[model samples]
Target chain A: MTVIKPKIAVYKFTSCDGCQLAFLNLGNDLLKLTDAVDIIHFAELGMVNPNAKVDIAFIEGSIATPHDLERIKNIRAKAKFLITIGACATAGGIQALRNFADTAEWVAAIYPKPETISYLATSTPISTHVTVDLELWGCPVNGEQILTAIKTLLLKVKPAIKRDSVCLECKRSGNVCVMVTKNIPCMGPVTQTGCGALCPSVGRDCYGCYGPSENPNTDSLSKQFQQQGCSRETIQRRFLFINNQAPAFLKAGMKK
Target chain B: MSMKMEFNNQEYYFLPHVKINALLDYLHHQGFSCIGPQIKQDAIVYEELHDSEQLPWGLRDYQMPGQYRLEENNVKRAFSWANGPQAIKPQLFKPKESLWRVARDSHGKLTFKNVTHEMKPIALFGVRSCDVAGMLIQDKAFLTEPFVDKHYQARRENVFVIAVNCGYSSNNCFCVSTNTGPQVKAGYDIALTEIDDGFVVTVGSAAGEALINKISLKHATDEMQQAMQREINNAATMQSKAMPFDNTRVVRDLLMNNLDHPQWDDVAARCLSCGNCTSVCPTCFCSSETETPALDRIESEHSREWDSCFTEGHSYIHGKVIRDDTKSRYKQWLTHKLATWWDQFDTSGCVGCGRCVTWCPVGIDITAEVAAIAKPAVDDSASE
Candidate 1:
């Protein structure tokens, strides 16, 4: 007799909804994933069963609300393994921009009456509240990554994908160095690699979609950019974006 | 892996009588789909051959530091432009199209349909060298990737490439620096160079051999070959004016080290956040899938489409976009493509294709930006 596929669930908090959709990008693989795992919950596709127990949960988005705090706890309680997908679930996400500024003033600027609104002061990743067994990073997670994550989960094996930056992928594609060939400012060196180095391939630089991976040496990259003629101010502001709150980029951004 | 076949040099003939229409007929008859350049309202596009009559002949396109426009030039041999207004990427790897969809049936069962179309053998005419290089670059991005884009894989599998050796190079072209253009290279099935009275055709693949056998080719003399070579030489010599920078190992040392530099503010101030540069590029493959809510929540389906990091929603978590600040967004984009992408994929993100340079509404030249940042590295080891 064949072993029944494991049960899996997908969760979202605050994100571009890219990671959750990653399952959909698995056009052929979605069915295969469902066949391999009983999809217990997926809000975007209206596949939700809040009470159902799950073996693994793929969480996307950041936690910026009190409700999110409680929901993540519940997800963690039921899931044997929780995997975070996309930058939002790993970093504070773009919404985390509020971390550097005053929340009340920012809310008042947008809402007619800020006092009526209720929100967390800062956006944070799922790991901040729940223990994430694995983390898949990307601005909008790449489909191949989703595939790998699912396969690893089913087999109860650690995913073998690299946590290195996008620069490695660029070199593997045999492309002429964009920064060296054209002097373009790029983040491929420090940014994580899952997006297939898309931006650089199209004649543009990477925008840190995958966030920082492993022990990224952002300081060395920053100094190199300085030598490449980047002003101190330019470097600070750029470092403050996306994964700005990430320890290394945060340190660089906060420096005078 | 090197397959060689001797060209009977004598049977390789020129067909001066074959007008654009005849060539289209010939390509079509040989079970090949033709992709030619045509004027669509205001811009010249690489689309399925609308008609040979619409070729942008006798017109010169103007491409400056950050702009591209087609202008009327009295040169009658029209088809004189070195490159098309757009690259031939969307045909093979569509820019904004769905790859798959997730849906639920009346019985409340979920089903996924991998969105792929039948591949009609394509014959891309009026080909430019940089575009070919762009194709080669994209081949690595999509075809080389582990989860292959079955759609693109199908289209590229049966395509017959007919390369037109450039007699003229454009102001926006930097293919020469990438070691790619002006003269056709190995990827092409058949490469043609325009000669004075007739054309010189060089066949490289079995499909190209089959084509030469079918088309009534004329004897190619040494003089014809020499003339074609001189034409390609002239085109190569008259390349774009920008000097490509030396970025080897620059990613490991530069942008990764100095994240505190303030040059990003200047770039952010000029950025309109209009995602044009990324969309027109040949190798960007980042995508997002969206689910359209259905009449019955139980039967909703999901569809995947293109995505851009420049957008605020791209980095959203719970309720926030990670790189909400324009400066951070722009910085994330450029740095990731140039430096970090190499670390991830083991290759440079760019192929020296200057389409991003020409297409940028703000004319954000990446090559120039890297040069702007390439200062001597400060000894940060002591600071750390």
Candidate 2:
């Protein structure tokens, strides 16, 4: 009798590569994970099998270059279930700050030869280019969440990831509301909860490492920051940081 | 021990503020976890109290829309303010609980086993009238005839409530309008009204009478009861906010009829669709279940977690999200909270504790939204 294993692939584009590292960082689970699924393509793991058909594909990063646009389409077409991991793939990561700026002018200023650099105008999410079956949010996607996503996918069930804001986790963990108590400008209310509410627990404000939480009220949070005496630059930078390209945060940051 | 104590005639009792620890001790002796309001995380939240010293004695909360702060004052009363962000919902309906488990037996056959918890009787101290009302609403939800949640029933069965009648209203509180608070008429073991020196305690249930007998409570005079009533009446009448219009029909009718109203869009523009309002709402019982399968696929566990309607996926069916836009989702939430809930539950879901108003990052007041919908009549009649 022949045994068949589900093929898995991990791909990256224009991200910091932190999200891909999370899978390897699974440590003891890495061996068990490899046993569970055939990792056909994982560049970070030194296995590079591109253009090969896979059962599941974990896509990291956003579409920043013209090549990325084409590559992502190929990935989407080949993979049965294309799961987007990390804020870059889900909502366009930090480099998405360039979405607000002129890419041509940016290239002109940064490069010695102006016309040599080739890139898209806006750093857009993977979903902007192709259908994403599941999205694991966070600057570096949570390892547990990634595992849950995989397990759910194996069962042909929709992943049970919380779309609630960081405030829920913060409250559950009994962390004081930094924005409320200290009058600090925290994005916990608008930001997603996948990061385990790291920032606010340690006495700092959430910088929205995960993209917008479900129904993110960016306007209200922005107004709160303003009331907390945050400068226009501060408010702008707060929304435009990790997940700037997120539609909700982008509008709030750009509002005034 | 099984005999139900009879003391319905002795309704009012007194507990000197200093000796309130006796009540906590008595509950502890009965193998009950005493849950009460304590100052933590910048605001007062219900926490397990091993001793009465853990209570937020001298603290008071300054609550407003989008704002909450715990300030230390000279007020010697233990339970001064109405209530905090958390209600009895988390207690009865756990935020996250393992319902059951599934595993493969030695014969390689899948076996399902229900998760059973040895739940201790929980004595909730300092619960407000509005929250008790919220619990009653939840009781209708989890304990209803069609499908009763066994998990909720098991936990709720042994719970005891020590309610606190509001001596002063919080800035956003309007339990007066809802007719659920300021003075608790039902749904408590013992209702305490804080006065000059101590609390005027009133028994509600048989368990309350038994507990009263256990603690050395003094006989309450008619004068003391009158004073407590005056204090409660003052708190009710002095409430700064209430429903701008009657919640019975007009507000519900307006919201239901004005599904396409411009006010929804206006509110949606400001609304982040953040599920904070629903999460903090005591009566919002929306939940989602998930299955966690093991690596071997032989074992799996099912769990239920709190879910909110604000999420696009909450309305997702097949391959499409029903309420795609924020405006429609917000309208759906508002309509359900005020109107549709009445039709479904045979009562209004809101208890008017003002947690939604205070906790909303944007401060989207439900009352204000209703007022905007029921504009002309509300404006004319609203005297507060």
Candidate 3:
């Protein structure tokens, strides 16, 4: 009997390529993943097929350009399962800060010839352009999470991604609250728990790198930050940073 | 002379501040790991203690709503701080633990194996009265008839508690209102009240008496006893926060009657629903289970982790969430913790350690919330 491996592809759009590094960081586990699936296209790893029909497609980055808008739809059409990896593809990432700003003004300020730049007015998540089967949220999606998602998908099971706040993970790991102890303006209470409570564990405030958690009460957190002596601009900037385009964060960040 | 004297639970002795090392050393010699409070990550937390030197000596903690700061007072007293984020709950009811594993053989026979952890007997030193109360409440939940948690039982059975009477109380503390703290009442093998020079130790169990017999302790003089009582009384007076009503029945009735009270909406608006309150709550005992299947799909490990009502997953029923909004989730948590817990376990879930108030990032005080809801109704009725 012959066994046919699942064809897999990792695609990039407008990203920092940090999410792609998560796969490489898998190290020896990457070899195990390769044995389980056929890597038809992963341009960063030197396999260069832009258009390939695959069982699973891992998308990194956002749909920033007119070309990205069309490419995502094409990728969606080809992929049996479309999984958005990292903050960029899932929630429009740090680049989505452009969504809140004047794109024309910034382009004109940066470029000598502004008309040469061909980009959309707003940077949007992959889900904005195409139907996303699953979303793995993080600044750079955790390698273990990506591996687990793949393994579960291979077994025809849905991946169980936790949608709890970073505070939960922080508590479980026995880490003291940076916000409570040091009066630091941390986003752990409202941010998702994918980074294993990384920032707060290291005595730094979480900057919401994993996006807004389930039912994130950003208004309450913002009020808390304000009470902790954070300025209006600082509070806005905290919410509007990495996952600025996320609906809950966008609404909160835009608040006066 | 150090001799095995017939000591009862009521007997009090003085163990000098310098002789605390002897107590820790004795526990270690008895094949028990001594766990005590220490300064970790800017907060006082319970960690493994090898000697009395590991204790948070002279470190006074200032705890307010949404704030906790530790400062050196240059004193020599251990267990001077009120409490930390956790009690002894995590020691038995772990944050995350594997329950069991299942494997399938080549012949398709599935074998199930229980995943039992090898835990050493723990001597929990420097525990607080509220924490002791919290443990008893947890005992009612986990160790009661017909529904005994075997995992919790395994760890709890081999445990020894060395509780401490709170010499000082933080700003958020209201154990006096809850009638649970400032003085060690019960549920301890040995209870210690820290005086300026030494601890007025009261043995509460045979094991505690046996341990005390091994150490040379001076008979607690009336002066030392008076000093211990004075410190405990001072701790009670230090607390500004208090429950609106001391009666749990009245509090429970007020909450149950006012399920749709506007205060719920007001609190929900301010509450992040981050589960921080529940996480810091020593008596909150909700856990969720997950099945992790191997890549081969032949084996799986079942695990349970601490969960909170704040999450959408907690109220998840068939195909939909019961508590879909923050209002409903917050209502569920507060109601269950303060009101309905009595129905389930014949006691209030809160031990009034004020951990929830101090640890909440947004500083949502449970006592204040209860007061907000209850005080209005009482005022209106009184006016009538």
Candidate 4:
């Protein structure tokens, strides 16, 4: 007979909520996944806060508000294996753009009463506040990868995905490149490999929606972009867009 | 030697139509998963072939600056993959969609399962010389990375590569400059140089040599080898550099300084964060993951799929998008791949495949951009 299933929790902070939707996108795999674990808490599905102790926890989004700062620490303390999913949870997400600007001035311009709201000046990942066993990347985490990480969690093994650029996936799909024929700027050569060369297939450039890979060569690729007639602003804007919080993109984005 | 075989010097291996059909039967019986070119949705695509009829023989394809059209020609028994828009890495490396999840069910049971890698021996027929270089470059990303990808390693092992030397070069083909083309180098199990009447096939591996023996072919004379060399040399002579951007150091130094170069604002004006450039690049590999649920909702499954860098939500910090300005984000992508990647991986990330040139809507060519920045002195150097 199966013993008590391991308890699992899904948490979110600041994001487009696309990462949480990634869980809902599990489709047929959702039932199969549930058969393997116990879903103790998932606020998006109305699982509520103050979740119970469990074997694993999947946290989405980044820590932006003061309330999130305390909440992240508590979640880390309760879970035995904590994994961060999506760009927001792993690299601080697009919200990290705030790091390069005058936060007070931007806040004053937007909010009616800037003093009334209390939040962290910098939006950061769970690892920034505590420890993270695994990092599942992407702007909105891919559902299939999330499942792969969960299995690794139960088996007590390391993750299988590594730091390779999107170019690898582009080659694997046998799709003709959009950049070469169209003279377009594609991030496929430099961005990490998780998105299967999707944009190029449909005639679009990579905005770096996924974050950085391990040992990424941002400087070298940027040099190549310059060779392609890309202006300095064009190159910098690409980095500052989707994954400005990722150290690789952040360093380039905040270059000013 | 334990074995020796002889063949007639006068006879050629260009078998009759009937024998050619029979040869297909023999290859199929041996469990060869043949891959060749086929038209897909109007454009030609390379995929698996179930039989001999599926092979695009006697087909010469014409490519313009931004177009491709296939025409039947007698002199077309070579790898027409000759500077096509696509590169062949993902077939031997990464995939688009994958399942990786750990979650809990309403029944209070913990569950976790990942999609298992598959075993499929593939025969990459009619591969161009530059594609072999593309595969070698992929090794740097998937195999050489800190955590080796067992999936890629396994898939690569099952792949039997049959590379063909290109007879002609395209205007956009830059493999010669990249040291990746015209003739197949080491990575292949077999290499073929197409000549009149039949192909001059050379076996690079023992497996290829055994296949050569099986084909009942003759010993190639010294003249035949010279002709093969001549074919490759001709291809190289036809290719010339489109851009002369040799100074990579200046480009790297400029990016490293973080001096807020004014050139970036000009770039941003025409920039579209759609991600066409990165997707078609031979080396870019950034990605993101996500999860989708089952329709029943009894249990939710997690999946780690592909993501891109160009998306606004990608750089969210807590709840904020980090890259408010698109200009900086674009800069990070190009610099990392061309400049910093050398430091991280000990080699230039790009193989100069030239896919980024045609696939881009705005036609952003990396090689051209480097030449402009590497011009020695920046016009706005005094502003700093």
Candidate 5:
């Protein structure tokens, strides 16, 4: 009798590669994880199979380049279950800040040769181009969430991930509301709760690392930010940070 | 000199405002960690206090919807404010705790170890009446069940409550409507009422009597007792803050009848679904359990952490989420808290400390929400 392990793959496109590092950051769990699933392809682990037919494929990063556009479609075709990890693939990442500005102007300002770049004007999420089975949200996805997602995937069950705003977890951890108590312009009320409220616990405001929580009340929080004396630009900039292209934040940033 | 003293089945004494440290010292002498509100990060948080200096004496908090500010009060009353950010919830029902440990030995047999603690006496100082009521509500939750939370039981057993009858109320207080506040009626060892020059302390339990008898306390004069009662009455009247609805019955009935009310959507548009209300709520007792397996995959520990209904994962069952929309989730939270809690616990869940209103980022007021629903529909055709 043979026990068959699920074939797993990790791929990256145009991200900072921080999301894939999350898989490696599972230091102790990484060893035990190998016993549970077969890692057929992982560039971070030095195994590079770009077209492996995998039982589970964890895709990180956004579709930035024209070539990336075609490549993600191919990966989607081969993966039985495609899971988007981090803000890059779920919502357009920090680089999606370009979406708010002119791409040609940004390129002209940053690059020496404008004609050399072959990137898309808007750095769009993978789900924008290809269908996604699930999304694990974060700036750099939480390592524990990745392990939990993988284990749950192998067991053919959905991992328990909270879609509530960070304010919930922040309060549960007994952190005084920074926006209320300290009068800081925190995005915790609108941001998803995967990071276990790491920033707010330390007396810092959250910048929506996990993208918009379920039906985030961006309108009301924006009004609160204004009442707290946050200038229009400051309120706009708050929404344009990590998960820039998330619909809720994008709308807030664009609003008057 | 231990004079035979009796007042309402226990001893009654007047503790001078300057020697309030004596009470702290007395509790400390009895092998208990004195826990009280101290200013931390601009908010009053419950922390271990070694002396009266740690208490928020001479400091008063101004709390409104979406705002909290601490200011100097020259009056120098120790228990000036009604309550703080943290309640008795964290002291008894912990935010996060390990329930038990499961380990697979060399023989491949799993061994279970219960996460237990030796009961230690905790002297909870300056606890408000609403919180004492909240603790009793939680006692019904954790103590009496087909399953009991032993960890909570252990902490609860050795608690020495030193409840503070409110000298004043904050802008957000509405405990009068909840019938849980403005005075410490029961569920305390000792109750303190702060007046102009001193504190009128009344013992509520045997332990409280023994501790008060140990200290050199002047007998509370009839005038002093009347003055204390006068202060308590003033404090109760000063709570002009009342729920917009008539009573808990009206609020509960409105929620029960108006399941599809557009008011939910109106509130949900402002509601962050952040669970801040539930987390800060003294009576919201939903929790979720998780297993933490060691790197070896053999040793594992099971733990339960505070969970809120506002979270999408909280309603997830059979591979699908029930409350997918923010409106629905908010509806479930408010309905459960105001209405169904009565069905489950024979009492309303809200104690009306108004932490939910003050702590909410958008400052969505529960009282207002309840009132909005309870209003007679002017236009029946209106839709969410």
Candidate 6:
């Protein structure tokens, strides 16, 4: 009469461990999650069987090193569903800023012993190496979004993540348009909605932490930023900030 | 009494500025929640009104393409601004609401329940003429013969509309050209034109007459009537923007014929396709539905939220996105709003309140787009 619980694992590579905190921060929900699934390998939560075969594998961070490149491929083979969580695992995160620059120079400048480091020439998302079942995008994916994904997966259904812009959420929440009213040069028009229009709701411009939305018109948004008197560097930085390696944002940031 | 005689016998009343609260109190006593325009987060938004003092007074909104600013004016008036991003549309057709829910028990049997919220009768105060026009258009959309939306109808039937005639026009306003504003023409229980001293009220229905009769008011004098007319005329004349054509048929034909014009490419380049224009548009009624099951998989709720044609999902049918590009999506929105809307609903979707223009983050003006398509510039460079 008992049902076998789905085995879940949390893996990290070159990320800041912030997205893993999204699961830990699920306070009471974390306890309830234990009742629903078997957490076979979340190192932060003290469970550390990394090689265990799991029903679902939640991967965080970019494939920034030789070890990450090999580890992700092994994890992909072990897991039935490999879902990438946060900006790093999906779009190479803020560290992917190194992808645009000379990684050798960055390592030499930052580290006292550059030869001690064994890293890839360019930081890249996990999707670059192995197939990703789904991608939960954000600088640190929110707890609610993580829960929604797990809940939908439990029901044997695909998670319904809206691919609309942050502007839609801002309108729904009845937040005044900061870009239009205060000339804040908000990226809400091109950014995805997972952050729930967080920055604009607090009178700040969106930094596009959740990454570029579906069919984002980055060229038009760049033009808008220029019209708002934003410097070329500032406009580029806006797109290249958190989810730098995302294709649409990378193309936008690299534009002249 | 004959209809003409009854109309001739009707009297217009003047409700002084101070007596506005009394109207709110009367509506409250009648079990109707009053909602009116008030300054919130630097914009005039419709919220629950417990007192008339909450209305935006001595505040004028300066709206342009992609900009809105609230400035204090010496003139003390409540309804001086043109309109906000939202109207009475959201009040009835909610942004998101659960339609129904289904639950499964341990026995593996399922049960369904309709999730209808207990709605209170809402008395919308300070609604503009264009918004009133929007309400009528929505009524045609949601309350039509074959498939009437029960949730929308439930809220629509229990609503009281108190419209206000515009005394001033914002920079993007073109209601005069649309022939739908500057004065409250139809679709209201009561219409109020604000003068210096008070509001000159026109009762459009028996319900309006009943409410006005409860409040002791002076009959509108000839001077008061003249002042109201002057204010309305000023509003009409001050508008700087206009559609390409006054006639809806002409506009429909113009947009329908020039479907493949280069102007669409020009607009598509500037457009972010963010759905801001559709969200701000009072008449745009597209919605999308989603079903969310509880973590336990024992219960699930099906809900609908506001959707826009700008979204790629809106054009998705049978695993194929028909309008895969921004140009095609923008074309769908403009054509459907101005041209195809008439063929579907027998009325143009745009009411020309200009919320779409002002609230658009990049300021893609609908009127200007229409004008470009209607009259393309001469290709003198090619000749040279």
Best by DockQ: 3
The candidate 1 chain A region of ten consecutive residues with least summed lDDT is A171-180
Candidate 5 Cα misplacement greater than 4 A, ranges: A1-9, A23-56, A77-81, A154-156, A231-233, B1-10, B17-19, B103-113, B117-119, B145-147, B244-250, B258-262, B293-300, B380-384
Q: Can you list the residue pairs that collide in candidate 3?
A: none
lDDT of model 1, residue B337: 71
lDDT digits (tens) for residues A3-120 of candidate 2: 6889999998999899988998888878887777899999989999999999999999999999999999898889999999998998888888787788788888889998877799
- Candidate 6 DockQ category? medium
Candidate 5: deviation at residue A67, Å?
3.4
Q: Write the per-residue lDDT of candidate 6 for residues A108-195, one digit (tens) a residue.
A: 9999999999999888999999999999999889888988889899988878788889998898878889988888899898888888
Local lDDT at B217 for model 2:
86
Error at B345, model 5, angstroms: 2.5
| TM-score for chain A as predicted in candidate 2 | 0.96
Q: Report, for every candidate in turn, its global Cα lDDT versus the true structure.
A: 0.68, 0.82, 0.89, 0.65, 0.84, 0.89
Better of 1 and 2 by TM-score: 2
List where candidate 1 sits over 4 angstroms from the true fold: A1-256, B1-19, B105-108, B246-259, B317-320, B344-346, B376-384
Residue-level lDDT tens digits of model 4 in B73-93: 765353443555544554654
**Candidate 4 local lDDT, A181-255, one digit each (tens):** 345666765577676656756667777777775435566557656767889898898888777877788776555
> What value does the interface RMSD of model 3 take?
1.1
TM-score of each: 0.56, 0.88, 0.95, 0.57, 0.90, 0.96
The residue-by-residue lDDT of candidate 1 on A72-133, one tens digit each, is 99889998988888878987787888998898889999999888888899998788888988
Can you write out model 1's per-residue Cα lDDT over B102-208, one digit (the tens) per residue? 67678868787766656677888777766776676677677766767777777787777777787777676666665667776756777778776456888767767
Off by over 4 Å in 6: B1-9, B376-384
Would you list the rank order by TM-score, best first?
A: 6, 3, 5, 2, 4, 1
lDDT of 3 by residue, B154-256 (tens): 8888788999998899999999989998887778888899998889999877888888899978789999999999999999998899976873777899999
- Model 1's chain B yields a TM-score of 0.84
DockQ of 6: 0.75
